[model samples]
Target: MERFSNITEALMNEAKIEIESFDIKDGEKIIAYFSEIPSISGFPYKIILVENSDGIVYARFRQWDTEYDFTRWDNGVYNLDRLRIITDEKILSQTESALLKEYLSQLEKIHLPENINKENVIILDSSLWKFGFILKNKNIDYTWKAATEDINVFVPLINLMREKYLDRI
Candidate 1:
């Protein structure tokens, strides 16, 4: 086995990740992707976005907190459709509705452009009541849940992206 020096190296080595190409008009930025994920068994899910500020890579996704008032896409544009609460799923009880409200509120905190297309929105909430898959270290947030991070999944993907896109190798 080629022992990697760190988590980033491992993911890039394992996944061999690659990024799809897209057009950008000079200063125009792309909204990589935002997804609300629910666990496989369906207890928890989370809102996450893979972001790249020109050359700098970062993830703006996080666990929703009451204090957060949806609004930050530092250097790139966000798909506005995500800002709204997803009502497609049927809420089983009032408590579920309340939980959905919380999730929607969190989604609102992410500032989005008015003309964002709905087709570009990718919301993958299973039960629609819970979300996970975000890890925070100081001010930087990564798109991995506590469980996922325990096994070291975040850095590898980061490394993979860097290797494929930035050619950090």
Candidate 2:
């Protein structure tokens, strides 16, 4: 697992999501957040989730299709022509929000290293998963390359969001 300071910010910008647009109460704190960035095969798509202290979860799912010019395909030249993006947001139900909080609690107890470098492994076209949490006295951000054992602990949470939100995209 790796940590990044601007992963969330960059993702929000890419998805054209405004954090201030969310109706988060003044006293409501952000408890946990998650994002997924897919590879070129799934380019122009991003998923994000933010859960607040008041058991409110906000989801943003974005996907786009691009028209590419491949006239010089043999020479490996690809030009972008047009791009269309579609974005969706949903405020999770009370039951789903509660389940998300429970999953986050379980995630907080898991043992995850600060970093792991697999020098022997070569990963291609894999997704990047990022998670952020506000603990007792500090904020933690964990980024992983593709699916790793350390990050798999929260698969259920990811799956839940994907099934409820991303599946429609």
- Backbone clash count, each prediction separately: 12, 0
lDDT of every predicted structure (CA atoms)? 0.28, 0.55
Task: Show where candidate 2 strays beyond 4 Å.
Answer: 1-31, 51-55, 67-83, 116-119
How much is the lDDT of residue 69 in candidate 2? 17
TM-score of each: 0.19, 0.59
Candidate 2: deviation at residue 159, Å?
1.8
- Candidate 1 residues 1-169, lDDT tens each? 3232333233222221111112234543322222323332221212222323443322232222111212343333332322222111111234433433354344446542322223444556332221222222112222422222232323333332223223111
lDDT of 2 by residue, 1-169 (tens): 3222223334334333322233445655655555555554353454556655655677766554322312223353332222245567778788787787788677678765565333356787576666666656567777667444655565687676677655543
Give the best candidate by TM-score.
2
Worst 10 residues of 2 by lDDT: 65-74
